[model samples]
Target: MEYTLSPSVTIINNRQVLVSSSSPSPANDRRRRRRRRRSNGILHFPFVFSGLSLRFRSRAVVVAGAGSYGGYGSGGGSYCEFSCLNTPIEPATPAGRYLSSVLLNERKLFHDAVAETLEKLVKEVDEAYARKALTVDSSEAALHRRIAELKQQECKTSVEDVMYMLIFYKFSELRVHLVPPLSKCIYNNRLEILPSKDWELESIHSFEILEMIKEYLTFVIGWRSDFSVTESWATTKIKQANLCHIYTTSILFGYFLKSTTLRHQLEMSLADPIDDIIMNAYICRRKNLVFGHTHNKIPTSPFDGKRERENLVSYLTGFTSDSLAKCAQPNSKEALNLITKYSFALFGDVGSDKMISTSFATLKRLVLEAVAFGSFLWDSEEYVKTVYNLEEIN
Candidate 1:
């Protein structure tokens, strides 16, 4: 049987989507309400009243506090990063729920606990380095020292929450700068978030790092060959569950872009015309190369004879925050060590059954936010390491 929904309910039907918060502010995602077009006093959305089941959230929305910081952009200067720290945030929006890990915290009035929590997680994030830095070679030793000093105003490095808040704030700023006009696709009058100028502009990525990305963005927009590369953008109906995978993949793509860009810049500074950036990029993406592994074999197909569950990590590596540092280049092995253990896991899984029809415009904003996120992470990785000794600066 076919179903009909208003634009709002239609958008919410996409199931189990995930983070990104590419809009002007995390606050903009705070409360999403689907307009129920009343038809004879009954909520008209068939999805809501249908016999098919839907998940309901039990816990009150609670987000961590992002305290003030002087170095970076105001670290959630308002104290509440997602919604005043301790109130319901977007119970209706499936996409915002994937950030549960980043935003989930107790109902506390102050953000001090979050800082403390992040401080403790620093060692956990760098556990491998902490355990092996001294025993390893000079290179790993150097990376440990570098991560020891990675901070902004000491507080950012000391408490990653400040940095996290800064990234959130930064993306909000970009969303304003990169507003999208209504799509020109007559059939796809549905709104998206990137500008009309960029709709068919080929690429939004920087030239310095374009080759390295090599369809890495397949996770976000799908294979370039699958659609008109410069003539038209495709639309997909993403289930909320699948949305989490896409958002996380986009973030990973951002991280990869930054790491490659830095590696390129570093090579340029060396005054040598190295021709293996993409080679190093491929080396960096190898799952086996994680944590100083010397394995250099190309990863087998995501599923080699075995079912997807057997190759789950390899399969899902492209879908979650677990692959942040997996793109370590052969030369700069410790490129991502400073922010190694960081993750973007946030919010509860609330909309497992919903799905959203993602437009090219929405995809555009998501890409913009991701690149911005990667840039900030790279900056923090450099800043935090610029100073050593991993002590909390409270």
Candidate 2:
């Protein structure tokens, strides 16, 4: 039926029949008067009012249309109607509600908590380490003594602790001028935190270390290839441990990158050599440690695996604040530590410790040497990926 809403307004159903006349009846006139009183009066457009439904729910006008027609009437007049919705509807999705909540928080309650949290964590670790180191004089001295003691005692060590001790021990020979030693570089000497460009870019002349690393990289490139090498059993064991250190360090570095603002800033500031340093670190730390124990042969030693889960946490807790401070800076120490623990947990589940205390002790020294050599590419004069070039920083 054709419903003629007003003189200009008309709505046709499937059957061609007039529902209302052009001249208004008393009831229609009253409806028009009531609509005219409302601010949401019907628009005078034939196409708009044809199949459209405008709902006035809670005094607000809402326009809803099914379809539109091609042309207007003979008089070139178009009209629209604003109908009332008896029942108000809630939105189907929580997106609108969420947006409102976000808006509210943004206006009054939003606060960034990362920086403060990181600072707190770093302080805690530093204090703990400071306290712990008192037994052996300085932290570095104590660390070195501990390394020596561990070697003598035949005790196992965490990859991180072993890495730290090895790096500290090699600082002098590595030709890197670490200001205030480990203490200066770790906390705040952002300007000279890492080794100079020359120390990093030097070509690795250590063929034995290079050969081991190269062989491992080759194996990694062809990971699908059957794991068989013609090297001596001793060499094979060394390679396996080296591979584990590489994997462990790479994973840790990645975590550090994501966790800490300082590390991220360092990456941003010295883009070229910094990335190279991290990449080299990754390459150095690369071990055959896979995530899930899906393979036939385990990549890392049981000792390394145990260290990842059990000893690593204990080791970290000893200097947790310091390490966290280095990475998270003003925020996210607990968050980062939680992430580390979770990652370590995953590693523990997937890997087994095959490395003996002696083997574990020996590999750190090897890894230190390998890392120093491998990371030398960053010191090359020609390498120039830096923030100065991008004008991100002066």
Candidate 3:
């Protein structure tokens, strides 16, 4: 039997030996060498003495280093050096996009959880209200108890904790669903809640609604610019120590009108009172008015500096009109001077408890003082005449 070595094999022999074996009848020796090489050194031939020729003898003596083969060298030697032929391998399937999809799924799950909690709260409140209304008893003691229990339970469980649990569970579910290629693609893809084209209109509508709500809030908290003694005392000394509350209420009313068709109409109404004050002062200044003069001329007096100046001018003008100019005067300057002299006697009077009591009494009286004054002014011309008479008498 014969075995053929693979093409990977290479054979080499000494050139000197080949030339020595190429003498007469060299063909037979060459044939034997070829046969031996082809058979992978398995064929063994004993040397023949009679037929021994120099060529045959030379060929039979194998050179030690020259005899080497490439294919799977003998058992203990290195294996054959074959060309590396790489077979085609498929590319790895991607999992990056699927990760984002899983995250989105988790977000949706948590959102649903929060929504569920809000819905439950709404339902509980509604049910409690319904139960209270259905009861025929005058007092809703049982309903109150049930509501208290529900509130306690809800207070113990935070909305954030519920959302976190939902997110955990949803992530697990997403991982399971993403086993297939289609599921992975669907989950990872970006999902938009609203279409792009409708966004502008939606934004405009939202702003309009917000403006309407703000207007409604302003209307519910009304405003008054004219401060009443009663309102001031009630707010500062009795009810609460906050001036901002009254100021904010007044500003809100002004802003509320700006949102309506009544804006210009209200502005016209406000201009009347402002014009009255400015016009009266301008007319008085133009007339070169000199009022009465009242002075205590005492350094120890604690009268307000501004109030004293005002009183001095008032008295001096009265004196100029009555004595120097001989104009129609309201009353006697001596009596007015006497009244001004005694004004300092009204200070440093009340104790702490007395002050508080007086403040409370003053607040009560002032509560309806503005309304009464307005009523008196509107009712009759005689009322105004009486006020002028009283001023003249004083």
Candidate 4:
């Protein structure tokens, strides 16, 4: 049997290779030019290949195009189809554009950027771990030292690091769904439940805050769950220590644990079975903590970080005005009712918790705390620090 093949085009890393008939037709050339003109600005590429004789192989020459797209996971190859897009594409935001540039670069700029940040965080965590190691007895100290050693080896490219990168990418998709009001509400509420501790107030990248919360939540979940049944003592200890590192990393990075409440679903998706156990325990222990909700609808416009900041600022203005009015009439039934509802919204139905009662005095104090938290949310800096827990970049 004999077979004939039509001309095709394959591009690898933006370099175009054209496969065509030895006797090229003027019609084909015109068609190719028209196709290229139509396919502008779209990333979708179709793959096509056909077999031919060595005689025709000589015609399979490379053609340099004026423009090209760059990315991974196309079997290291692609074929651009210059056809009208079936659906309109969403517009790009500044952050999305920046991420796309970093990601599509052949020089691996994105990986390097993330690696630099991850390394610094790991080093600080290692030093903290080392200090704790010295305070323990010889046997315990040896175990701690071993754990530190393992962490040094694994910290830069750990599963968490990969997951962090994934979360960063996912941010582009979820940016529209990032509910600042609810995020702020949940974050502040969770922090109020913690033991008395002073958090350093500093601005950090929004995604940095999200990643830190995720790491902390994963650690919290991992710490409470028992691993002795199936895993060795060293494995369990090391796992717990990693979680501790993540927790301390959150603190050291100056990332507020409260911010994760809005993005907890993303954290849950990235968590392992052991991490899930910890999350489940938290839910069982505190049934009413409302993490912000999400929906599946995609937005028409790209997520504008600037617009988000502006909206959050606008929302905080209204939140403060309303909250203050209620605070002014502290003794009114309306005030009491307002605090009770706000408390329930933030902390969930705390009816079971012995420490948190519904008394007027208790509710009043909670109302005041909400005012303080509202202030905290409004004090955000214009730009996020590249490295949290580090000196603010000018």
Which candidate leads in TM-score?
A: 1
Q: Model 3, residue 299: what's the lDDT?
A: 21
Per-candidate Cα RMSD to the true structure, in Å, reads 18.3, 35.3, 53.6, 30.1
Quickly count the clashes in candidate 4: 1
- Put the candidates in TM-score order, highest first: 1, 4, 2, 3
lDDT of 3 by residue, 118-144 (tens): 455445656666666576375776867
Q: Which whole-number lDDT from 0 to 100 does residue 361 have in model 1?
A: 40
> What value does the lDDT take at residue 373 in candidate 1?
54
lDDT tens readout by residue for model 1, 1-394: 1111111221224422222222122332232122122323321112111221112234343333322111112223121122222221122212122222344543231234333444444555566446455746765676665555452223333334333443433433333332211111112223233343332222434553443332333323432323444323445454444443443344545655555444433333333234345445443543222122322223233223342222212322232232333442111212222222222122135245555454444454554444545555544344333222233211
Error of 3 at 324 (Å): 66
Residue 58, model 3: Cα distance from true site in angstroms: 99
Using all chains and alpha carbons, the TM-scores for the candidates as numbered come to 0.37, 0.16, 0.15, 0.17
- Report the CA-based lDDT of candidate 2 relative to the real structure: 0.26
Which 10 successive residues of model 2 have the least lDDT summed? 381-390
Output the worst ten-in-a-row residue range by lDDT, candidate 4.
47-56
Off by over 4 Å in 4: 1-30, 33-125, 128-149, 158-385, 388-394
Please give, for residues 74-143, the per-residue lDDT of candidate 2 as tens digits.
1233211111110011112232223223323442221122122223334444555455556566547766
- lDDT of each prediction vs. the true structure? 0.34, 0.26, 0.24, 0.27
